[model samples]
Target: MPAADALPIPVGAIVALFLAAFPIFWCAILWLIAGMGWRRLANAYPANSDPPDSADRIRFATLALGASVRSANYSGSINAWLAPSGLWLRPILPFRPFHAMVFIPWAHVRSVASERRMLMKLVRVALGGDVPDLVLSGRLAQAVLDRTKAKKR
Candidate 1:
């Protein structure tokens, strides 16, 4: 009895498969972002214009979305800007698809509270209306609160 030879996959076939799957993957990401409440937030506070030059930029920040305890955690992929007018948030380039940049004004921030979770100090900022609260690191949250207080004065 003779053994049959194995056929290798062509490089063109692999590239074609990836090309075909790209759009489907992108759509799935859009759906996931919507599920994470990003779509709702974007509708409420879309960033039509660019953030000001004076805004303080914070990279590799963490964020929590949704109202439930089992919310979506975007760890170390968020780029936040603390401007006098409001807080600007957007995901990094790779995760930016279907996630629009949003600007939540200081007035919308109802309250800011700090809490210790495990070893990390977390700050939760409650916003008005139906949007989810934003959870950030303690230091960053303090900066946001300070900015709001300064704006008031």
Candidate 2:
């Protein structure tokens, strides 16, 4: 079907459709491209180890802003933190302004030694709240902790 003839078009619906479709579309594109490259790299050599024993106590370093240290291992996965409505998570690179993007595998942080605000920031962000660039949603932070705790059993 032609793009225009498929359905009735309203200006607001068009905008909503774009908003709904753009991220999923781009993420798929990026994942396909990145996954292809990652597969090639993995094929060239053996993996260092298995994915994980069971997503156990994997401590991830967090900066003051609550963002975990960036890693090249990022694959396309959605992670979020949860917190009360007041906080938010903002993505950022070291020494740079915040970003709205969330990268995965790299962001699959597993543990922390102490409780901190940056961690809270991450929780806020994960909950899809308006928070600083480098943060996680509080809900996600707890989920990570819970996952680790479960692994101990």
Model number with the top lDDT: 1
Score every model by TM-score: 0.82, 0.24
Which parts of model 2 have CA positions greater than 4 angstroms off?
A: 1-7, 40-153
Residue-wise C-alpha lDDT for candidate 1, range 1-153, written one tens digit per residue: 444664377688989999999989987976786667777788899998878999999887888885376677778888888886888999888778888999888878888777787898778888868788888774566677677667768
Model 1, total clashes: 0
Poorest stretch of ten by lDDT in candidate 1: 1-10
* C-alpha-based local distance difference test score of model 1: 0.80
Candidate 2, residues 43-139: lDDT per residue as tens digits?
3322233333333221233322334453122221222332221112222233112123222332333333334553344332222222222332334
Backbone clash total for model 2 is 30
* Global lDDT of model 2: 0.36
